[model samples]
Target: MKDQIRSLQRLLAALSSRERAALLAARPAVLQQPRPRTLHQLAARLLGTASLSRSALNLGEQQFLEAAVAAADHARGPGLPFVCGRRDLEQLLGVGRGVTADRFAEVLRSLTALTLAWPDGDRVWLHPDATVLFPTALGRSAHGRPPLPAAAPLVVAAPTPEFRPATGDGHGSGAAALHFLDKVLGAFTEPWPALKQGGLSVRDVRRLARILHCPEQESRLWLHLAVTLDLVTERHGRWICTERVPGWLRTPPADRLAYLAVALADVQILPGLPTQDPKLLNQSFATTGPSTHYNAATLRLSANYSAATLRRTVLDVLAELPAGQAADDGPALAAAVHYRAPHLFGPYDPTKPPVPPRPDPYGHWPKPNVAEVTAAVLRETELLALTDRGTLTDLGRAFRRDPGDHAALRAAAEAALPLQEKATILADHTVLVPGTPSPALAELLRDACDLEFRDVRTETHRITPGSVRAYFDQRPGTDPQQLLDALSTRSTTPLPQTVTYLVRDTAARHGHITVAKAGTVLDVRDPVLATELVHHRDLAHLMLRQAGPTVLLSPLQQGPVLEALRAAGYAPNSELKPSAARAADRSEAMYELPQLLLPPPRRRRGPGVAAPGEWLADLSVDEHEPVGELARFIYNRAPSLGANDCNVLATALGAGTTVHVEYRTPARTHASVTVRGPRLDHADRLTSAAGRTPLPLSLSGLQLVLAVPDGRGRPVRGK
Candidate 1:
């Protein structure tokens, strides 16, 4: 510090006497007194020309930040930190009761995600660098925060008899997760025919609903989860499962549940919240019509807001309601969801290409106002059990921290899974599971048996001849009795005699009707399709010729021949011949998960190195040209006036200011000149009292520069 002071002092004293007079006259503005920088200047400096670059903040995020800064500036207390309550933020944003403090938390979460802000309970603390955005807080009054209201003694209140917070079994959601993979596998087996906009049609969802035994709305949610998790993807207008399903099937229930829960914050069923509102599907934004239902389900609060925002909003809402006060299921959280994302449920007329967006087709249709986001939060936290309901089970405040606790999520999924793996073997060669199976077991069972029925509570399967044959075919060299033995181990009762007979009988007759491509002919013997082929119009063009009573020949290639047979009255199935070794490779590679467009994580940058000064200290050269060191000193070591120094010049521009100037004459004599009360302008150049000429002090025909207060603290109205 002393060295810095001495360096500044030396620089100040190096000036010539005459130059000092001129500088003294011009330097009073800076010397008058130290003052805070104006808001405009600070904003320009801190925000920078490319301030928004590399920042993930969307329009909503940016708006939330500005609102928070404004709030911080207003209620700042004397200290290194500034804190604001949830209520203060609401008022600062000029919001109503409809905008719950939780919504404001959505904004804070975004800021926290960026590491720009953090929250403690209801109070928030911003990164020190963020303070530059609010220059008005500089040198603020040394006044502390006013004392908060005294804590009131607790008073016991009578419990309400009517309301009870239902403990979340996650039966619906958990079952959806377990069943979602099944739907994807079904899609993979038979791809979903996609719409022009690449969305599923009503028929597609209805089929899944029927199969999964869920409502169409819940089915759609499951499909969305599949897409969001990248377990299912679209290829050539058809939805197909990815290569990762084989791996996903083996994952534990907790992990699967964690992934499913993660997906909830993914595809927003309703624009408002994530509650199971019975009428939620009726909402406009929750449309299953097309992808345009919600403006874009890609938008989410967690990705946009900071963890701090979530914590603050949650704490504030709970505190305001009182301890143990339950707000579940209904409109209790409608206000908060509305405030957080007002445009969420609003009408969204997507800009369909080839059609101008100025006038909208669904203009008359009102937007969907989702009151479910809060419900989803309540569901996510599993916290309503803490509020009003004494019957509530313990689910620690998971949302009060990072990305949410996977432990709680895992527990929910495990608890929902049926523990009884035993099955009842029926006399008719069918199996009935008393309860739902975990995804892993379900997948294993699916490999050996054909699923007959599945609902929220039960699952049924049958070991048909075809399923037994398929099980053996996939395993390649397994004995019929071996699979039967495994089945016998799982069944509470003995395996039925008919089932074993069918399995043995099917294995004996499996290869009896072999169809293989022959030279210049597609041949099938003992199939009895010969008479049908001869009379079939589509087969007529294939030039089919009867080689024997049971066999027919066609000149068409294998693919075309198969197509023609199917075009006629035949059900042709393709089996990969050993000659095609690549088929097995393709089957193995097909299950890999599809990648999605997820954003990158937040980035942290270290402070940058200071740049060298632009001005040279001195320039001299000798005839021998040994001036390299001199040049280096002059250009590299020299210091230039910067931000702090600019303040000195600004001080001289004060109104009614006066300064004495020292300038070189045309004759080059060391003579002193006086310019009275010259105004220093924005460019850091001197403005003449006459208001016509501008002077660049260091370069305005002056050999040296120096400044000291002259007629200090004075401002000239005009010359």
Candidate 2:
């Protein structure tokens, strides 16, 4: 970088007189020439300077420019259309949602003004020459070093992330993530499906959150991750957690967290809102703190973020707090947020404001809802038990600093109930189990079967169903007497009369109407559709025949058959033979979140931070001694084919050497061009390799000229 800067400065000074005059006239105070006229003249001229000039762009813009150029150059032939939206830009920059959309637009404008970019339809496209203009990773420099990797996917954690030692009872968060997964397991396997349109409605979420004692948004985040990872699927407009859940259950708890970490890392969805009421939450913070709901949501998901910065911010706060205690989790997370993304938060002073009657020093600041950002990320950590009371949890430390530590994770995984286990049947209607039963057991018990409340945590699980119909079925091998006999075998004690009678009554009614399906038609007996079929208007249109009062025949398929009967006001329930594969992978299509989460681009690889000749370009000389040192430095740094013009110009002209020539374009805007093979006319105009001949330029327009060295040391004169 240092060498490149030096080369650029000398190049600027040694431009042809015409280019020099144009450069002086094109200084900040001068009006820039309109495009297509001064475009060519300034194109290459600006290219050299923009490389060394950081003034036109912020760090984010610089990164975007390099990424766009590299991706464009490699993926497509240069100049093909590429995407540059909030998503691509934000991830490329490590920016979270905290960075506003408007700020991104400002960066785009800067690149365009430099002619490095231009608006192409809705998205901006790079100039065709951008790859050459500022080759950060592609083109090699004339000087032997390779170009610096553009925004080498900046490593987070300033210097590096600090890891605190872990301490716990060796019991990890008791498979908190899996425990949540277990409850989800129960919901998916439950007989009465609660999902709406394949997604758990807010109500379903709230209910599940209540049952699990987990926050609504946290549950949703995990569920979203589950869906994203293909562990769960959607079918019949309802979510069917995939076979992976059972696979997940079978794995040790530590492994579950490991898998979850990968899935969580891939989540692009922001944890929506906290469980707390928004209006109430807003008031709790001072005067709503200038953060709108939209801003709050965006900050968590899309704000530019730096991992190192977040770690530093969090550690700094922890340093101030008492050991293992956090003043507030939200602020701790928020501290890291703005610390990592100051641009996203703007100039807002996050410190508490002085009470009224005093001027508001922080009034004009762009106060984002840092609290929401804090809360959202905090919940994410909570899933892995990464935070205990807002401070980083020992497990979290393991996740961040010591990924190798699997002991704690292993302990957590050991704590979840085993999948298959022996059962206990009791005289009362309830059944008992050992360990936390898997969803498979729960599904077998589900006839609106719910986990019942009990005083003892480790006691057998009691399956509580409202009626006996939940257990009895008229399936081929099932009989009330057989069910009673089975219960007796599982229990050492006699079955209760209530239990006996319940199974008997339910089984007696189960198959009263034996339904048989042959092709599309359903044959029913036991007074099937019975006399009602003969009297029904809708059934009259179908191929219906009465086979005695107890039997009716209909040609309609099962689904349409049920619908037609129901439409005619007959109350009927549709039941099909149970499928061996419930919510099988084939039964449902895997749906992805609307947006795909892309991992952050990997860090720059390979070597060569300095482009070719970049060392000479960036090398600086002491300007105070311009008389001697300046001349020597310029001469030494000058390309072997080109002579430095600071000390010698008109007297040392040669072929293939560059000169800064000033000229007036048709637009009359002052423009500068660096031309080679000096050609001058008495009219004071010059043209060279660029072939932009005969443009108007005065003798005075020739401000500086470079002399190229011919092997014979002979200087070329204008013909």
Candidate maximizing lDDT: 1
Candidates in order, TM-scores: namely 0.40, 0.35
What lDDT does the true structure give each of the candidates? Answer: 0.47, 0.46
The worst-scoring run of ten residues by lDDT in candidate 1 lies at 613-622
Q: What is the Cα-based TM-score of model 2? A: 0.35
Predicted candidate 1 versus true structure: per-residue lDDT over 380-474, tens digit per residue: 33311222221122222332232367776566455545544568878787788867655545555777788888654577898787787788768
Query: Which candidate number has the best TM-score?
Result: 1
Candidate 2 global lDDT? 0.46
Clash count, one per candidate: 38, 50
